[model samples]
Target chain A: MSEEPSPGPVVDAAFFRRWLVAAAAVIDREADQLTELDSPIGDADHGANMRRGFTAARGAIEKEPPETPGDVLAQTGRHLISTVGGASGPLYGTLLRKAGKALGDSAQVTPEQLRDALKAGVDGVAQLGGAAPGDKTMLDALVPAVEALSFALDKGAGLIDALAAARIAAQEGALATVPLQARKGRASYLGERSIGHQDPGATSSALLLGVLADTAEQSAAGGTG
Target chain B: MKMLINVPETVVADALRGMAVAHPELTVDVEHRVIVRRDAPVPGKVGLVSGGGSGHEPLHGGFVGQGMLDAACPGEVFTSPVPDQMVRAAAAVDSGAGVLFIVKNYTGDVLNFDMAAELAEDEGIQVAKVLVNDDVAVTDSLYTAGRRGTGGTLFVEKIAGAAAEEGAPLEQVQSIARQVNQSSRSFGVALSAVSTPAKGSPTFDLPAGELELGIGIHGEPGRERRPMMTAGEIAEVTVDAVLEDLRPQRPVLALVNGMGATPLLELYGFAAEAHRVLAQRNVAVARTLVGNYVTSLDMAGASVTLCQVDEELLRLWDAPVATAGLRWGA
Candidate 1:
């Protein structure tokens, strides 16, 4: 947890803003698909819920233009909690706010700090939701992605490459939820019938990490692709 | 989708506006989508709050008034209300007597209420919660996050709201709420499905002669699907399932709830059958209510709830209530 200004690609406030924006774009594109996935086992609003939350989060960050990544994330957390309905709002809001506080007010982020912060976020979400990995929840993807990033960073992986590894891990983790019976959320109401359906929360969690990887790669390459 | 609504996005708000116009004793905070008592923050009285998705009418919103909930926060159809609305309502209605949240046992409602309670406490407002989880159809905890709270929610809200209105302290109100939740059990039967304004399609396609038994209020999959039976048979099955869990050998409050679109005549028929079934099992029904207190937005279905009651619970249940949904003794 040393804050000695470790050298890295600058994942500054601008990077965090881009991450939120990218998340909104991807979730909006997949909103219908998310709802479709939710139709069978849920109230059928996961996609619209995430889309509404991310849109508000994105709009908040863009409007205020916070000076630090931590500030940006904290703002996003507050907006999401207010905008999104259902369990996603509080759980995701806890994730971002806890991570933001863990990072402190550093204008930029180091890979080590990012790992710690994301771990804090994941832990906060677990605590808030009373869910663990293998519960067929967003934690399935989020926890593994954070663990992968931490593991890669410990072995001296580049920040962008670590994020890429996390993204892959998240996608795999999300896919792994397909065979598991839901033990959390609305799908849990279905009991064994919940099997063979991918969790919408896990799917969105994977989307979140994929955007983070894309943001890291684009920013590091000195191009905003 | 057969709906009497405008744009899907405005269904909840539009309904709130209509309620505000129709009920002079309630005020709707359109900005926050909360329905508050016209005279909220009652002097020396514990404020009560409860809410969930919009599809269940005459529930959280219609139950807001003089002797029921002090405020109700409505979400979109079949969705949990956000934490901000709950937090704001508690702050607005807290009169130093504290506030109690009657939350149903759903993942979304639990998390959001927990967050709201924390946020409310950070602002130095006292908040307590009573989570109702009385559906007894599913037995495995490994499969469900927990038992789904259904018809029992209405019982807890009314009984606890009576205690709160009598100037009971926060701890006392919450205790009474929990006690009500523990003594009740419910079972639902769906003869058809509903289309929320937002979804614009039936929740699940029920065949011509099939029905879903032990269904949740959200139209979530039931315990099983079988051919639709006669009204008396359906009533007996649903009522029997609840009585098995309730085990009410003494006096009980029987509620026969219609799932939105069922007719009054049909509800009465179901109610008579439920009463007969309970009597056959030696459970005395002291008070009976048959209406659509908790609904699934025009789904043709019915649910039966039985609450084992002692003298104290009967007193509370008979207390004057003037909510839009239930008005009588007042």
Candidate 2:
């Protein structure tokens, strides 16, 4: 693959902050949709829960202003754990905190470093929720998104292109959950009835990845100037 | 929506405040959302901690007292409480005999309580967990998240709490809790959909002239929806569902519980039908409790939970108990 002239924006603390801000916005916009999806098989609280968590995470990051990308993620994870109520709180909190810890106080992260950290984070979520890729959980989107990011990065794709690829993979992963039975979380209680309804967690995970890609693309465009 | 609250945000807090005033024997923590027995850590007695979403009133919280739970963590409506709340509750109630977490088997409740047990263990407190997943409405535990813990939770809490109150060790208490869970089976029927405070609308739609069989406490749709049945018909079906799973040779403790919005007038009338069904099956009833013990916040329905109890469990069940939600022989 031909390399782009610019490597794209530096993955710094500010970039992570911007991604979280954008995430909060996206979650707020999609809150109703998420709750609507949850209504059928799960309790209708995923959208409100995510909105509360991401909003708190964004606010906490803005107020404290962590010096490193790792600190931002770790703090955001802590905030999500405390603010968001339900399985999503601990699940998402574990993902971010584990990823942040893997980042190891790094002042800046490369796309490759971010990929490895996210892989660790996704693994943490699987362990915390005891769910696998086909469990109709957030891992459906997250596992594939992280794999896509790693694959694209290994194939020498630029950060923006790789993130865009990850976002698409995540969206596909969310869509795939529509046909599978939920093996974990509230939706699992529905048993066979859970089928045909998209998982709210997977949908939100895709939204988060999409927001990250959008933020990265914007930062890269601004960085070119 | 259109509920009796100043605002949706303050509902849990407001209820906690009301509980504190009404039941001065319990220490209510509004900010941290942990309620403990006023005389907690009753010196060498094992601590029993149970909690879940706020809507299930008189459950984890109201059950807190001398013979039931040592502490209860109340979460937002239909949402599991965080690990911090559970950890704090463990610390406040642990009296060197360790603590047993009586967790309902909801995905959020299981995950949060599991994390809390880990956190509490990290703090040098011995912690054990017994999951109550007695709802037989959902048949496949292997494929799904397992059975949803419904009305049987009360049976576990009361029996296990009695054991703990009698100074049972954490291990024995945990074992008894697990045994209670194993012996119990529940099935719920929803005559109408439930409306949560946050949504201000019905969580699910159960059209008029139809009812949901095997409905979850959180308003999750059950096995199937059928035309509304008479109380006797509903009772027969609900009790039979439990009996088929339990197949109890011994006498059983029967709890014909209301699902929040249901009235005792209807519940007792329903309980009589349940007794008739149990007699028809030749399953003797040891103790019968009929009320709104575990509820799903205004979802006009009732659930039948039958626990096949041995002599020891019967003794524990008859033990003196004093709590805000239940008190007898104390």
Candidate 3:
């Protein structure tokens, strides 16, 4: 059996902001790949839409850095909603905004706080998009991330450990969308033809969770070293 | 993967610029991606606004002018425009009477337009919405979301734009638009998939010998794929599908639209076959139009839209309209 790692420290507002910016870059780097996957089922604009949205979010966050982690996420949400111009915009925006609201005015967020925030974010997305788990949307990734985060927190894991768990779950969720027959969005109009393709939204959502894991790990190493 | 474009990022802006250069009467807002009539929101007239993804050129944008849309917000290719753009459009086009939003029934389009209407209402502008869900290929059953909004948008825009231009109240224009939408049916097929400029690849894989039937506008796979058929057989299948969906008992206005790559010659051939099939079924063809009114980038295919016409619809169809993409009556 492999040895388990120790829990890490809490994450602060600046760390969360950095993670948001890094998430944008990750999306930019992987955009062409997302577009390629979308070519088989969707209009090949997922990359362009995500790039525009995250670019705007980065700009907004940099201009007026948030005092709290929640504020940073809220600003990101607003930027995406105004600029992305697609189904992804409003859906992803709702996710960030709702998560941020749950974080409240706290400058630093603990693992349990982050878990609650993710739950709020998932709730917001469901309310705004009316999409459930098997709909082959961002919700697929988001639901898994939330479940993993909650499970880690219950086990007394720290921020870094929980985020790592969330990242793994999110990636698995994204992969699961490949064989799903889309029941929502424009892809659903294709019926059986939509099967055998990965969902672009779920892929992007997984990247977001992965970014969080990377940032938390880096922050933890910097703090303890 | 061939496309006629200068740059990927500037496609919509460049197209709008070309429109302005080509038509001096229509005012184009390069920043907002909205095209408006030089003199819009005619005093005491209900303003009409319609828009969608940018690739369906000569649509919401082309239909903006004196007798059609007062304004149109162009989104990025195959993406819905945000609520802020629609809100700005509503504000720019709102007269005292109110503003009418003619929206396609796609989820993104519906949600964004609904948000914009709410924003406009909050700003003291009265607004009404009419969703166009005219594609009969997909069903609006309990199991599925519903039929997608497709080709018949042009018919609704033309007729309702005319009604609005003639000083109809916002409610009247919206009601008439809904009536037209309810009476129309559209079905499409794709011979080849389209390529996005940024992606530089086809949206789907279609073998040389096969074609996708019952396709939507965004290059989404159709209901079925089968071996390629002759233009005559294709038209028969398309017309038969629409006829079965609408089951109209009256005269109909037929629109045979190309999916961008199909040339006018092929469209004419398809229309000829469509006409023959309609005649055999005893379906009266009141008016016929064949062109690339709505397209899916460079996809090689065509769609058939039929609107059951009454006296009022026929009058609206003949109404004088002027815009950058289409023009009639000097």
lDDT winner between 2 and 3, please give it: 2
TM-score of chain A of each: 0.94, 0.97, 0.94
- Superposed model 2: Cα runs more than 4 Å off: A1-5
TM-score, one value per model: 0.96, 0.97, 0.96
lDDT of 1 by residue, A51-162 (tens): 8899888887888899999988888988888888788888888899999998899988888899999999999999878888988999999999998998888877788878
TM-score of chain A of 3: 0.94
Q: What is the DockQ of each candidate?
A: 0.66, 0.74, 0.67
Docking class of 3: medium
- Candidate 3 wrong stretches, greater than 4 Å: A1-10, B140-143
How many clashing pairs does model 1 include? 0
Give fnat of each prediction, in order: 0.72, 0.70, 0.63
Worst 10 residues of 3 chain A by lDDT: A1-10
Compose the digit string of candidate 1's lDDT tens values, residues B229-326. Answer: 99889978898888777777669898899999899899999898888888788888889999999999878989999898899999999999999999
Ordered by TM-score, highest first, the candidates read: 2, 3, 1
Model 3: interface root-mean-square deviation in Å:
1.3
